[model samples]
Target chain A: MTPIKGLVLAAHGSRLKASNEEVTEFTQVLASSLIDQYKHIVPAFLELAKPSIEDSIDAAVAAGCTDITVVPYFLAAGRHVREDVPEIIEERQKAHPHVTIQATPHLGVSEALKQAVIHLL
Target chain B: MTPIKGLVLAAHGSRLKASNEEVTEFTQVLASSLIDQYKHIVPAFLELAKPSIEDSIDAAVAAGCTDITVVPYFLAAGRHVREDVPEIIEERQKAHPHVTIQATPHLGVSEALKQAVIHLL
Candidate 1:
């Protein structure tokens, strides 16, 4: 069986401590829920938050994972989604050529999201 | 017709300046697209960004809007969603009891969001 390695939840970290914790807690909950399939689930941040994308990717590689999937925990396809993330991915790919990297998309407007918004309304 | 009023996009403005501008730009684009229905679409920030929610709401009321819809530019249901926003809404409601206020939900993981994410992948 192809070794299913790591799932990395990447977020834009906030300088506010509580905000950082919020994203970390969310990632933890998500990781726990996906424990069955993913042997390892980690949280990384673009800034402010700890264990940044670079560190998380390196950690995953160091932990004997040849494959990593990066999931961006963002709402829109802004500069971070359009530029920063891809640049990071390219850098990581070059640094760890043997490791396969897959970057998921930003969480954009969708039915479920719209419904969630409606529920809040 | 009841004076169709304003739509406010509330975001957590970043100190990084560019981040704040990005959200502002996105809100402007959305507003431009929604001009037919909403006479005014304004961008507000919880912090850092200019034109706070309080200010935007006040502007809407000043502009003779009896109803205002606040859409949170957030990705998940965190403390901001569960706590901070409700307090702001309550305060707004009390201040402008005659003005109808609607607080929409955070853009949680949904089909559309998921699809958008997938598209990035």
Candidate 2:
């Protein structure tokens, strides 16, 4: 049987409700685009929000995902991205050793984002 | 005589020094790319960082820029983008009546950013 893949869009949650909602909505949009590649796509928050990284990972595992990818949707590689999110991922990965859970670089470091900023101007 | 244009990349300032540096460095890269269009391109903070938006605008005016654009380098349109940043821009525009100052939408709302996120996957 083919391994079921899962994806997580990890974001730095905001105190503002709308801000968190925007990430959730965007994740839905992203999930639709990646329907073929991922059986499950979830939006997880670092702080001040629901469905945290650990919870998201566990849920993906429960959903029978054999492989998972976490992408940080942040503009900078701050402590949250560098330390907090990674720590959560590390813990979750150990808890579910059978599942291949890995994190990609945060969004800010992407060269594509730099080009996008120029295009916005 | 042509009006000298200035661009301000306004970001949500971080408490982490390295986080702030990343934004400042990105602004420099952006400035290099926009050299032909803008006489001055500066990075400014909303809070928790140095070189506040008001100061950046004042410096741009002092540097002989008659027109300025402030682009909020933020992932979400939170209180900072919707209210705080705009309030500062409004106050600064009135303070410098000779200078035309305006703000663009925050980075998150861009369709290109959505595409970029997909590309990263």
Candidate 3:
């Protein structure tokens, strides 16, 4: 059983171009750091921007990933994280039933982020 | 001059009660750690919830803070951060002309958070 075949860094894309670009910029940083561990690391948007979650999932599968983990770059487990993202993934699953998709908790609850924010202050 | 007289860990409150609560929960963690440095640390909402930016600003002034900092707990500097939040702070400034109200960049682009996400991956 291979572990963490692919990783998707999903964000709630913004309407403002600058705001959305920041997510893409941060994703590049993450993609670089994660290159050693993950074969396919992609940045995707939930809405209001390019590369919606479904497209990201398709890319992962196209890159020969059978099992993928989608980590929402959101602050909390909102409906988008809890419901919307999963629904998108589910639809993708219909096309690639062999693939295994997992969703991680949003970045909001990550203790690492909590500690980081504290350190930032 | 008082250094960081007060702090507001501001969030884009969600329609989902659970999602909005997570911001409050994170704010408590931030408040607990920041209490030593800041006399007042408040959790405020940008919209869709209670104790908005204006109310939080009022509270900070009421707490005897002359120079206050509002830190947006958002992933990026969207229209809300670039326009809406500044407008709110401007209104508050008008109400409390003597108080020094400042708005920090949103939580996005923080090297600390970038490091945290890298470690998390």
Candidate 4:
């Protein structure tokens, strides 16, 4: 039987305790909604927050997942999305060449996201 | 003559100097393009970073703007949007009842933002 893969939501972590907690909570809520096929949903950070992208990917690999999708929880396609995230993913892919690594797009202004924002407005 | 109004881009300020700088840079770019009617464009923060939202609004009021729009540079419609920001705006409005205060939506997944994200992908 083929093992089920997982999703890793990467966020630009914050040093503020409340801010980090907020991101983690959102990721947890998002992950809980998806079950059955995609079982594991992990949240990783770029800086300040714990469990960096490297750590989360390593954890996912350890949990017997052969394929992973990385979603960047960023608002813009700036330096982090343009440079930092890809570099980290590339480095990790080298280590686990067999695992299929897919880096999803950042959470920019999408329709769903726009609705969420509009609701806020 | 109707006095000029300003727009304030308020962000959840980061301690990471680079992150703050990036936000400020983006606001500057955005402000520069709107040079005709709206003159002053200021970037304020919730915490960590300097020039808090209160300070920015105060500055705008001081600078002779009779109206101001406060744009929340946040992703979700969380507590800050539902509660804190409104409270701050109310306090400021009381102080400057003559100034029209408008709080814009957060930058969620809009078509433009999505395009920006896809570009990163």
- Point to the candidate with the largest DockQ: 3
Docking class of 4: incorrect
Q: What is the DockQ of each candidate?
A: 0.26, 0.54, 0.61, 0.15
Q: What is the TM-score of chain B in candidate 4?
A: 0.94
Compared with the true structure, what per-residue lDDT tens digits does model 2 show for residues B64-103?
9999999988887667878899999999999999889998
- In candidate 4, what are the lDDT values of residues B1-121, reduced to their tens digit? 7768788878777656666776677666666556565768888888888899999999999998988988888755556766778889999999999888889866543444434433433
Docking class of 3: medium
Sorted on DockQ, best first, the list reads 3, 2, 1, 4
What does candidate 3's lDDT look like per residue over B27-96, in tens digits?
7887776788889888889888888989999999998998888887788888888988899988999999
Judge candidate 2 against the unseen true structure and give its global Cα lDDT, from 0 to 1. Answer: 0.86
Screening candidate 2 with a backbone cut-off below 3 angstroms (N, C-alpha, C), the clashing residue pairs are none
Which stretch of 10 consecutive residues in model 2 chain A shows the poorest summed lDDT?
A107-116
What does candidate 2's lDDT look like per residue over A1-121, in tens digits?
7999999999888888998888888888777778999999999998888988899999999999999999988887778888888899899989999999998877764566777787767
Candidate 3 lDDT, A46-117, residue by residue in tens: 889988888998999999888888887888777898899889878888888988887876787566677666
For candidate 2, the TM-score of chain A alone relative to the native chain A: 0.92
Q: Per-residue lDDT of A51-108 in model 4, one digit per residue for the tens?
A: 9999898888888888888888775566787788999999999999978777987754
What TM-score is obtained for chain B in each of the predicted models?
A: 0.92, 0.93, 0.90, 0.94
Model 3: chain B TM-score vs. truth? 0.90
